[model samples]
Target: MSRDTIRADLCIIGAGAAGLVTSAGAAMLNRKVVLFEAREMGGDCLNFGCVPSKAILSAAHAAHTVRAAAKLGVNAGEPKIDFAAVMDHVRKAIADIEPNDSQDRFEGLGVRVIREWAHFTAPDTVESDSVTVKAKRFVIASGTRARIPSIPGLDTLPYLTNETIWQLDALPRHLFILGAGPIGCELGQAFARLGSDVTLVEAGTALGAFEPDHVAVLREALAADGVRLIEGTGVERFSGEAGAITAHLAGGETINASHVLVAAGREPVTDTLGLEAAGIEADARGIVCDDRLRTANRRVYAAGDIAGKGALTHLAGWHGSVILRNLYFGVPTRQSSNPIPACVYTSPGLAQIGLTEAKAREQYGGKVSVTSWPFHDNDRAIAEGDTAGGVKLVLGKGGKLLGVHVAGARSDDIAALAAITMAKGGTVRDLTGPVLAYPTRGEAIKRAAGKHFEPVVFGPFAKAWAGLLSALH
Candidate 1:
């Protein structure tokens, strides 16, 4: 293969969420940029992950809503899902978002696009099949792929990962999913709503990273939706033929299903990147980087899943901003210190920001106070008949908001408000000051914050003071 050497101000590997944003920003700033991607232009997010998954979830949610309307005086009968049409919807969503991340788009933005796999050849250089990039700075955004566990018969059995799950022509009669993380839970609930009998198996607790109370809410919802939740158990092995598969559990139980979807986890795509050639240090997790997203080689930075910071699309975009500011304006910002919000896009979406309750209790001991406001108490929730979950806020001394976990309708949107408040070092008072429109889910946030100050506002001393003031009046 003939290799042509090229030079640029920045060379970004992988055109996923992080790489695309970083490349565009750098190019718009008049810096010469080169972007390399071996596969799809938009990386895993647009091609196989978030875009398709969310599209499927939307369809499933529609199906579920139709069935749920009976409780609200309207009777929308059971939904008949055409699995092929649903997959088409997922594809159409990807097609709609594809142009924004295409090679032509980036090229028009003054970026030199290289469609090839890239690996480091030297401390300051990386090369692909037809081109070599020697840049002043390099950004690695290789992302990750589904981590397939070593189940005894997994290799021999026909299984689906996120990459291949969308390709199904017909819905499985019974869908068995491994892992209970965000992806597993989201897809499990989606398939169940789409009329598939879903059984989700997790080696550990379901939604283990989320607040336990919030997880309980989602667990109940998933069960109500016909998704069988199997927690605290691992798959001992697999058996059965192509049409029928059997997962033997550790506790001597077996689950038979038509299809098995593996959502266990993801592994970073760094094995073939030749990090050793460039002295870039990485572990099993991903490339090692400082809070500033810089690798051992100061000229190189890692972003997105490959950075080991967080495997979230939003976080990947944030990494792009951090890289641009540091490279162009000489500003040092730590990605870790920034308030990162995460949400599981299920019905009554689970969203969280900053420290969890357990983390807060561990860090501050008894100095922290945990306050909650149930959706049942929210007037909007009562009216909508969607009052399944609530909000939990962890507050420190002087009402400093340590964290916020919400599980209810539109919790993702509510968490965004909390993220902004936390970013600005605001407290519960700020949340309560805003007079949110009545009969809206947003009111739940304000109500939750109000609970934090209930003791002080309705205390005996305040009551006495109010009585005296009334007498004087």
Candidate 2:
């Protein structure tokens, strides 16, 4: 090792969501924090993931709205999408949000930001090319990268991953995507609406982690948007070049596409971190951490995608808070106890919190109750002419909220309300009491909650009582 060395109370590796949060929080607590990044400062979320994808989705939604306006009595002309300008918008979003996660920002916050690759050389020490860092604790926030599956001939063809998809100079003629998870579904619908013939191929059920009914609604929405969704199939092989690519499916179907975008999955970036030297246990998934986010070595902790909790940006930030609580304030907190919310930003959107209906059924069996309300019943949804999906709430005995699954316009916003309710140990009854404004999508929540009491509200006894009251009146 070189003579150059740095010392800090906290040393964070990888400058993504988790690393950035931990660095900023620790430094603010008046602790000496050193942050390291081998790639972009903002990592996957800011650079290649959420920000860019959402920007493209926004543009796609605008195009879709113009075409959909006919039903609303608006005669908007056909959208002329400038592909190059769309890419520029994506880049501008990244640029606008870049400075908040830049090296100068952290440096200004009194953090020593190191722009280099770091690896564990000892239990308490990490080394890079120019400097060695000895810290009281280490946090491995090295996020994930796009996972390329081992399809035959895949390596020989040019394909798009999240990292490189935003760089397209021209719109694809026919876009073929693999996987029907959030990434694949979101981008597939976006490109399809933007005038590309899109085919989304998924090996398992689409949105496998969500409820079947919710997935069905999104499937219909995507189909209506001109995306050819091929589920229960995997890519067996790839051939041809960038302009004229082909995918052979496991079921023997062949797809001819102008471009291939692999949204299959993501793998943790832990291979180069030299974890064995630090006695930190990590596998193909990510670092093996306890509920407190501590690795096998007590002095080392992990967060974000490398934590193996979930590859979500918000969860990564939550992990950072857990680290800060446990390390800085001596507060014991478990990462699993917190409610995790996820969303797929399609036109109708799909969002979920806590357990899915399938998981609730599997665990509680007869003890769970599922209530639902359709978007068509909502005034705003009908008025907006976007009534395609609905909301489902999974409750345990006594109406205790076990989960919330929403698929429709503003589903993410509705799921956020459910998250707060669940976080406070509230129940379906709790949601029913709130008098939300009329003619809004939010009223769907109260309507969904009212279903849990429908038996009491509409039973024979209630009808008899209503007859008595009518006679008295």
Candidate 3:
């Protein structure tokens, strides 16, 4: 069969978050656009990773709330979880948001949506089974997939990755998850809370990227949620089948579980993109790109996880804007100039941005000041009886807000307040100026900032002035 050749102003591979934004925005700019997808729309985020994980967490949160209601003098004794219903909710959540990223929607925007895997045949030409596309520019937004580690006998049995876990018809009696990073931790807690016996085995420290103190709080919360955590060790191998499985750890201990999942990490989807043919540099971390998100081939750009940047849906959209400005506005946008926030949704969620206290102190030494406030001191947390976590503020010599970490209810949202201030080059003082609403978790940010300035604001000079004013009176 003869292949149809189409030409366009822009050709985007992978109809994920980054590609969707680039396609939609370029279409609005009246540029001829062609988009390709190997699988579902909305990428792994809507179809697998973020959306479904959060939906399950939302279901688990309800179960937790019912269990905790007794503390508030309401007896919501032992909630019964309808596992199928919970999965239904997860599907509905995906379905509800599906149309926004649907192929029909992009086609409506005048984007030529190709439902085929695209590979580069030439520097400027991409071809699939039925058609070939030649465009002035190309944007690669093909995201990542769960990275499955090679362990002995792992492939001998059926296992679940983030991509396939949503098909779970019934909850695992005892779910064995490898890796305790954000995804592993979140899924472990969610399943345990929803009445599944869950165990998480990690080769490294759990949530090793976050500050030790903040990670401690999250670890404790995971334990309270009934997640059995095995850290600093790895699964030696796996044996048995889908329903009956055994995990042998490095230390010679074996765990029998009903199901196994590999949440170890994500691998960028680039093996099929024909990067070598196009001279684009890439590796295990994804495609190597500059701060402007340009690949070795100037004619091509990559965004989202595929850009070698860490996975964050918000950041992917930002990357699209950067490309737009560079391509059309000649604005010379840089992706790393602004600090990005990383958040984990594990019970009292964890959110962190910029430098950690240890990093700031190592860099600035005496120039750094650390201020922390526990949620126990915050009336809102006390009222709600969830006073497990707190907030930490890191500052530099000139009172510059270096970083902020929060582990409490709405901690991610609370970090937004500090993010805005930091993004504008504002100091901790900027965080303190606003009169945050009472009985809210966000007060923690302002409270921590106020603590950072307490001594200077109410010290001997102010006291001496107060006394001198009294004498004058």
TM-score, candidate 2, is 0.97
- Model 3 alpha-carbon drift over 4 Å, by segment: none
What is the total number of backbone clashes in candidate 3? 0
Error of 2 at 400 (Å): 1.2
Model 3 clash pairs are: none
lDDT of each: 0.92, 0.92, 0.91
Candidate 2 whole-model C-alpha lDDT, 0 to 1: 0.92
Model 1 TM:
0.98
Relative to the unseen true structure, what is the C-alpha lDDT of residue 390 in candidate 1, on a scale of 0 to 100? 90
TM-scores for all candidates: the values are: 0.98, 0.97, 0.98
lDDT tens digits, residues 381-445, model 3? 99999998899999997789888999978898989998888889999888889988898888888
How does model 3 fare in lDDT?
0.91
What digit string (tens of lDDT, one per residue) describes model 2 on residues 127-167?
99999999999999999989999999889888999998888
| Candidate 1, 1-473: lDDT as tens digits | 88899999999999999999999999999999999998999999898889999999999999988998999999979888888999999999999999999999999999999988999999999998998889999999999999999989999998999899988889889999999999899999999999899999999999888999999999999999999999999998999987699999998999899999999999999987889988899987899999989999999999999999889999999999999988998888888767899899998799999888999999999999988889998898899898989999999988889999999899999888889899899988999997778778888888888988889899999999999999999
Query: Positional deviation of 128 in candidate 3, in angstroms?
Result: 1.1
Candidate 1 runs further than 4 Å off: none
